[model samples]
Target: MTELVPTPNNCVLPRIRADFATFNDAIDYAAKSEKGMNFHDMRGTLTRVYPYSEMRADAVQMAYRLVDAGIGKADRVALIAETGPDFAALFCACTLAGAWPVPLPLPTTFGGKDSYIDQLSVQLQSADPKVLIYPPEIAEMAAAAAERQGCEGVDWDTFAQRPAPEVELPKADPEDICYLQYSSGSTRFPQGVAVTHAALLHNLYGHAASMDIGNNDRVVSWLPWYHDMGLVGCFLSLIANQVSADYLKTEHFARRPLAWLDLISRNEGTTLSYSPTFGYDICARRISSQSNVEERFDLSRWRTAGNGADMIRPDVMQNFVNAFSAAGFKASAFTPSYGLAEATLAVTVMPPGEGISVELVEEERLSGTRRDLSRPARYRAIVNCGKPLPDMDVEIRGENGEVKSHHQIGKVWCRGPSVMHSYFRNQEATDECLVPSEDGKGAWLDTGDMGYVDAKGYLFIVGRAKDMIIINGKNHWPQDIEWAVEQLPGFNHGDIAAFAVETENGEEAPAVLVHCRVSDPDERVKLRDEIRDKVRAITGMNCVVELVPPRTLPRTSSGKLSRAKAKKLYLSGEIEPFRLAA
Candidate 1:
């Protein structure tokens, strides 16, 4: 075997070396490369498809207008528009002006006008942006919220008219904060993860290197920009690499899953992307509905179908591959990855040209000794999240702070240039998350995820350490139990929460609670029985299934179910208990 070589400096710059001087040089290079590249969406689509010159001029003009609107260095500007050319331009403007852009998701409230107003109000207050830029439809909503908070609300039309300002770009330090990314808030209060320009640049270079992204690659993605994966993985990486890309609206993709594939096939896109579970389920559902999907388009150009953001399902991947094999979609295109918002975006990416690999381990053994990764009669598959990126190191340490041997589940810790500077405005939380070990040589960012590395040096994430439940000296992952219960027919699709609750003696046991839309009482009972039987059959542990009314399940601002909040409601009996499976 050949020895691994260091990446060439001309290929990518390190964070320390990527100062304002080098960053400007990179921007110049990108500008020169962007001549024929389209920046925005196509005609009739909500996307903007401008060439490099147009994108640069628009961004520069937007930067001037933003400064005139009192959004300068270090000021926060909240963007409430859907994904489009204007959103990208405004974001680039923020970066140019050294402003932090906080992108909030559009409010989703099926209740009524008041419900929508309330939700929007809460986000506006939380964001507290200096200026709120939104589309015409939500201009009034944004104006009212901004008025209530004493912030300025600028409609896109008025905001677009300002002439490009001639402000000198500041020399950005390596530690200068770039943007604030909020968590999904699925567990608790959403804290903004403060990423720096240096960290972002570093991570993007690593991402491009791992995915083999270049100026020639055309990326088409529909993931939400508010999320790190969409923002950094798709948008910023494209801009930094001077690559052309097409972005579809997240809503559009959700409504029509085939549009995602259609866009890729139509564009002959080399970089196919999405969160792992999403791409898998989307392909699965599409294949089930249409039989001739494989014959319709040529997916042979798809080089990298990236999978990240959530737990990777081996069955889902295999099913998708088998379903689309006739369509010229190579199984080798599936790239399982691991990353977090705290790491800017990517920490580890599976080796290039290599597809996903899974290790089938005994579930019981995992909970017991955390020893050998023995193949089980009923196995739990662990997909490789790949190796750490260049200049990054990953280690799994036990509670005692010592590095664990291969196959021992421990807290995943990362040390790299791409790690965020700190959590925004929360030093205490920062200290806790970014800490030094007992030996105190170097610092490591606590990923709070639990996983182990195999003998082949591949990382296999099992679950989150903080999400584990200790019941009767046994450790149980909510995902394990939740996956088992979710396999049931009624509980398979909707909002579900599985957590551990303590008895009067303080001993905890797995308590499964499911929230479904089914209204009929007899049907509810059958649903509960199905969930219980399936969970019991999968895992030997007997779980209690409680059925609640539709929409009772607490979701975060980003629409993820909050198991922590659900557990609180369950313990306090604040939730209305409907019927349970007999």
Candidate 2:
């Protein structure tokens, strides 16, 4: 019968500049502060208050244990990202021991046992980590994955309990590789993004400065630690910037999403929290109809509700404002950003207090197709993800490497100190994305995403070039097709995935796989036909539509629908859609 108190929102520590020589240096400074991390239960009640001082001590112990086990400098230690004190300590321990910590995603509910194991196995094979540590609950699957990769696997509890003799820990320089981050969708072909200590610190500095983080600012997050935004933006950034933060386990938030808001309500002066569009959509749908929005929450102090990790949905943002306005939530609190693991984290962050702003562009322009007079003009709302960080340079470059004018859509390219060192041991892939500069300033990263910057310098993202479906020499974005189907009745976000599939006549056509909630065979056929017609009307051509059961489509680790994986599974007959009557 012990009462748990969360960490204080404001600490007495003097706000230090994030100009550390290395990540370990950042941790050493943060350890002097009274601030720390707070953990919450499923119900949003406080469970643990971990001080930075204690965390440093625990990390040192963990580092000694790792060194005793012959895991030293430059070794790869893959850790299953479970939001808790243990994972936090071990992550810091890796940096302290001069080993690289590779944070991997936990088993998601969407993918069953075999799928999760396969994912881990592939990633392990790529990383070739010296050891894989995971929570005991997933030891069976973790061990299986490790065995497949021929590496040592141990539950974190058992590993932590091992004896540790005092040993010399290797020191890391600014140029040293601190960790490897795998992009959310990098499963079948995993490419670990190698980040240097200087790059990591630089990104954290830019992110903290972008938000104008004050001593009173604290973060409340439920984002998975495996993703870039969750790891660098929330976890590592806090330690570097000496900010106290609170957390709810990502899985627990999935089960009880409202708990995320409840913790925000409970924590006074909690100013910053981030998620993809789906997180806001879920919370809005969960509480929109309830008349007790004000009774259930107090969000007046929630200053920055950051949006990233996927396309920013303006409709979803408006819906969230409508749903939560009664609880003192301001529409201006939305802080949308654009970034990837390749940049370590925040390449561009929306200026605080600027809510979601979007531009309505012609659909044909977005798809890079000529508009036909016979068809009605359609428009897509492209969200403005904001300007680049202080050290970052943004450009829209054509295929020929010439930079395009403002408002002219092309590939998004960025260069900065925060850009990743390289793709781990994959020089070919590294060279493909990171094109070196003739002036030798640095390499510019081909973001693979298509976007344009406005005259005022704000970035507006179109879509991914790789996700485009080409048919008869015209380009079609899958988002447009999927959004067209989403307008039909009884549909939801992530319910449809659009990709190019080969037709019987050897022609390529857009194929939409929709989540069918209806169980009746007749109704299912009707639904498929409706979806097909809707897609055809938008794309001006016939499309193949298949009705699949709910949650049948695959999602990346960060919960974004994986169109590439969906197509692979569907073509391989792994995802058998509902049969339509012949």
Candidate 3:
């Protein structure tokens, strides 16, 4: 047996070692080692019939064509297309050419076309890409965006027309930048995190090792390509490990949640899939609407159902599992992982094969005092994000740069091969995130999140240290309070921002301002009361709930809520104040 060595163009397949004197022996070994099946454009009605081999070949050809089109090492290529074969091919092509791909989301995720264009403009200016490749339908929009940013736009058809070149691929160094992943920028402007080829490979290897992914595994996922989880977790990991995979359109899944489950059941997908909070919501809604929903899809084959990209709620996971349990879905399949674009994708994944693990502590203890993983009864349920990946190290440090002992809450700092090189050309911003070691020796990336590691080495995320609300000497995660309030009727799904506000005398109290889409004034008042009551019941904390018009809640360019800006508007009196019933 010989090992397969990866050239710059192709991801090296995992290999075994043997005494081989010639390169031919390694090539022969790679050929016989059983390459995994790969698929692109596994969406709409085409997934049932698309050949896996054809997709891989097409992607390789696309890579060569992109190289011939002057996209070579270090060149930046912008992708503004939907999730399908085209996007996957472009991504692979960029990777093969050693060019960095900047994937921007389609306009559909936001409320309107103008908003999308505005966000895209900002990204285009910051990335300063050489070419913009997009689908034919959106060619005009891409052209307009490129023209506005002083760049060229190439339609997919034209981009694909370039002949595949026969040039020898360069050897890629592990430290060379691979892709530029744009952050959601919920609290600030969007910034691009420059992840290196080494980082990407490290994460893929880490994920494969942790999940026990093999060539025989088949992945079914509907996550958007623009998202880090979708690209690195589902697409790249499948390619690097040579596993078969099927991709559904993110919008299609949103419109028809059953399609996501159907793809899994039909393909018998054995490993790999992910979604955010809204995905669970959509699935639960569809399952509740139909009779015998459980019998419709057998999900017993699913190995890792990764829940990430948003705040993970124990209630949401439990509800989704309960809804699909009748269909042979296992509760253990729900893996509560934690990650961000800066880490390429995953920093920690819940240990596979184990059922959902959680710790319940007292709310008062969690709010009034430090984190106590030992005081199980004093805190509410906090799901474990599992241990760090094999190649990574995690530490919890306080504001003074001292490491906290186990069970003490503090900012999370991580150092590993998977960490991004830096934010693209933004030294100040990068410096803020990638902090120096306390001893001034090495570098560690600050996660901007507050959490602690348990005695057993399981990590539990409390919340964003910046987003924590301090009211009357007690701390509260705005997400917990926000989730409680959002459960009330009449509160729009994306129209709530909760934060702590300081009064004239400098006393801090929780302030929840919700954007009520409903028009009836009486109903809005009732909804506010219901929200307040729910928050009080859950946390024993009194909150000021204010109801405003729809779309009043501020959001980032990526559509995530901007709590900091919301608070600023409230203090400046730009946001209307709501009064409680006298």
Candidate 4:
């Protein structure tokens, strides 16, 4: 017996019309082809190959099972979005049942069971899920969370075994809700962005057209399925475009970051993969000491290496390109993109082969400081996150809600057919951010991001609007201070969190929370002082520096540092800091 080779690089399937009214339509069309998803392990070995035909079959059965279990159209079905066939089938099953599938993050990285349960309870309360499906491995935590939310938690095995009663499946309409995508919570608390079928399809079409995605492209991803990039971009986009995809669990990738590239190397097709800055940074650092990287990996076929989810770090991307260029990697393959869950994943994408273009804006301008004509301009390299996708409009709005000129940094806003209907059950948040466009044709979504667009239409994100620090009437970005501290030898990426704290007199002061690995008291004190001085030099103001144990900082579900959560923890004295002399 011989093992069958997976979908070959050159074997192109018949392209499906991407104008589907709903995700079920796309999946129905894709079920005609043998091309499907393959799951790989850290060793680059194929674990499972699930074709669309089987997936749809299982999903239909699951849909019947769900309907039998009293789940109906428009009902909320929550699933712990682990990267596997069960979750995939259940997600699509919800579509067939005309129910809204809400993806909840897995409980692997949240440190302890209680914290995971708390987080899960919060989301469950927000979603008000009719049923919570999770792998049996996490039954303890899942059961607790479900109980707290007054919902039933069913393991996948039990759910699969449920009786599929003969009932008519609810038909989906174009205007119906497609799914609920939770924002990554990098800056603020996570909110479920309500995406409709029409909006999702439009976004998918625009994304496919923007990337020029064809049958030749294959997707390889380790991003968590709960994230928009992983759920919409990698998963839904593949089904819509009839492209084959390879997946490794996000947890597996964390333990073996190089496996993502290895899977891409093993697949001869032109690979399309996206990751946040830390993903690339981790891979580069892990493999820096290894030799024969060229022989071990073949990144020549990787055509589009996408960067998003957090601030795009040019230095980290450069390191990755340089590290793998010997393996036929091209610098031009880098695609820095800008998006949020509110827009259903992609707002703008760098054209293929354009690489990453950056603007060296004066530091003061980046921080929203009024220019001093006589001061020497210190520049910061802001990565250009390409043009908006078709039908997507990008605008920079000033503090007064007026549209800003090109290169003038302000809050980023977008309006398009793909923009979300609203934040689920959070009218206050929706009202605060979503507003009517100038022409009153459609609503504009306040992205809550600070950025500017160049004359050529490339967008450069500066920082989070809520995270900006203002001192003595001058604006400063926390990322600027964090990035400067990252340049030190002992510090690695993601070792710092910067924010603003109010003093006893109600004056705002910049605060820095650094993850220190050094155990020596004197060295820790020196490190704190050095960080404080560095921040002061940049902002020209006193900053409070606190040294905390490594890995003490809070992170959002999508793995970006949650500065807002960190600030809350610090202010509440939950984050115990090491004693350091001022």
* TM-score top scorer: 2
**TM-score, ranked from best to worst:** 2, 4, 1, 3
Candidate 3 to native Cα RMSD, angstroms: 10.2
Q: For residues 426-510, what per-residue lDDT tens digits would candidate 2 score against the true structure?
A: 9998999999988899999998889999999999988754676655323456876787688799989999999887689644688
TM-score of each: 0.75, 0.83, 0.74, 0.82
TM-score of structure candidate 2: 0.83
Model 2 residue 523 CA deviation (Å) reads: 19
Per-residue CA lDDT of model 3 for 1-582, tens digit only, reads 353221111234554322122212222333343343333233434332233344455656777777777778888899974776677667666765668888886766432454456657778888889888888887666788888888888888887887887776545566778789874322114578898777777787787777767545667777777777887787667656555566677667767778788767766445667777558766876788777866688888887887777656687678888889888888888888878778888888888877567877666545544555685545457788888988688999888888999988888888887888898879998998887765664578888887889998888887644675644212356775676566665455666788876466433457888876656668767777777776565345567778876678888899899897897788668999555463
Off by over 4 Å in 3: 1-44, 48-64, 163-165, 184-188, 364-379, 438-442, 465-576, 580-582
In model 4, where is the ten-residue run with the lowest total lDDT? Answer: 182-191
- Candidate 4 lands at a TM-score of 0.82
> Candidate 3: worst 10 consecutive residues by lDDT?
18-27
In model 2, which regions exceed 4 Å deviation? Answer: 468-579
lDDT of each: 0.68, 0.88, 0.70, 0.83
Backbone clash total, candidate 2? 0
Record all residue pairs in model 1 with backbone atoms less than 3 Å apart, i.e. clashing.
40-48, 40-49, 41-47, 41-48, 41-49
lDDT of 3 at 350: 86
> Candidate 1 has what TM-score?
0.75
lDDT of 1 by residue, 1-582 (tens): 453221111223222212233233444455554322232233214233455456666777888888777677788887874777677777777777778887765553222444344445555565567987887777766777777767888877788976765777655565677777764322123356888777888887887777766444567777777777888787777667666666667667666766677667766444556554655677676777677876675778887888887777777777787777777778888888888888988888887668889888776555543444474344678889998888788989887678999998888999887898887677887898797655664569988888999887789998744665544212345665676566566555445787766456433456777877788778878777777776554334566778777788788899877887787777668897785545
